[model samples]
Target: MSTTNQFQQAAHYARVIAAIARDRPVPPATLSSLHVIANQLDNAANFLDTDAPGPLSSLPIAATEALWLAELFAEDNPATRLPTDFTNYVLHRITGRPLPFPEPMFPLSDRLALQEVELTNRLQYLHDDTDMQVAHPDEWLRAVLSLWQKLLRLAEAVREDNSRSSHQ
Candidate 1:
């Protein structure tokens, strides 16, 4: 897609997310759409120029917004926690060991995109070091594929829930 088109699409999704945030009981279908949009934002960041007011600027905001909406959905049901199994696995696989989590100095926000942020940071870390990239190509690929699969599964789950609700 053209850069302008990507921007327009991202803006449209942002508006939709904002509208849903204004009301209660945000629908699973919308969240599913948000997940897809978030992926697109990530993809756009990959191929687009890192210009000001562009995909690079928009991506983190979009990620934050999508994560916030997903948290809203999870709040209604304790069972609907954010997906972490694949995140943890990818983290371990990339780092070659389980990472230790130190206590946060400040309280964490519900809107925090914990998994996405951590994984992206790790991926960036791997990408920056030529030696690491060459030495662990499989790990890097696995992390990328695993993250995409996790995102797809999350979107599919929301879609499945939406279908089930409509049928009921």
Candidate 2:
């Protein structure tokens, strides 16, 4: 799909997430549609793994813009907490180590510390700049798209590395 179409879909999903964050009621159909879009975007990112440029490398700028928007919308709202299991899952997948329950897992290890720092900075920019008083749907959508793009790149890289190692 074209970048324009991808941005449009990302914007739509961002709107859904924003509504949910705001405690505004989201229709079941809209929620389902957002899920579908998420899955599609994930799949597209996966498919782009075979190519050199990779899908995500082409998306950082847009994703960065989107993240700025999401930060604004999420500022006044309670910080959206990730499930405990999510962190555990990431730790296991990245380190191949079994983490005991209640033990803190550092997501930014030596290898990925720089990347983590960059991502945090971007998020901070979004949080600090978002004007919750003003409904900036465009900004919110841009932020979400940026995040989705980053996820796509990470997924592709992991998949590619796994595939190469398995063949060796």
Candidate 3:
């Protein structure tokens, strides 16, 4: 696939994670963090679809503008207390641990390509997770933060490869 395709897919996965969380009834703090993540992903992805010029063209405008937001959210001691598990999860993932996600309950849909006719407008809400099912919302948010950085790096590598191949 082309770099653009990889970037697009990376963006989609970011959105997929956000959509998944949106379906759950997480606390406002967690939701706020998710919102920051989703917006950055969306902005970065959308910017890639444009013809912007610069040394940091690979990064989306949102990524540049809000570069430190995720770091702050993942901080051990922030103005607002972050869930310890969430902080741990983010730290571990940043240190190279894999992201944790349950097998999708349904097939992954390409929301960008889905036609209105194929879309289901039903409010697909998730029940409050049991102690075992989720354990905590912070873990989920932390996983998302990790995923964003991972995807960004993957997209950069893909774009670099594509540039090299094209120049040849």
Give the CA lDDT, 0 to 100, for residue 137 in model 2.
43
lDDT of 1 by residue, 33-54 (tens): 4454344434333332233344
TM-score (all chains, Cα) for each model: 0.24, 0.29, 0.36
Which stretches of model 3 miss by more than 4 angstroms? 51-68, 74-168
lDDT of 3: 0.39
Tens-digit per-residue lDDT, 80-121, candidate 2: 321122212212222333421222223323444445456555
- Candidates in descending TM-score order: 3, 2, 1
Q: Which residue ranges in model 1 land beyond 4 Å of their true spot?
A: 1-112, 151-168
lDDT of 3 by residue, 134-157 (tens): 445444444443444333333444
Strongest candidate by lDDT: 1
* Deviating ranges (above 4 Å) for candidate 2: 1-35, 38-111, 132-135, 155-168
Q: Judging by TM-score against the true structure, name the best candidate.
A: 3
lDDT of 1 at 60: 43
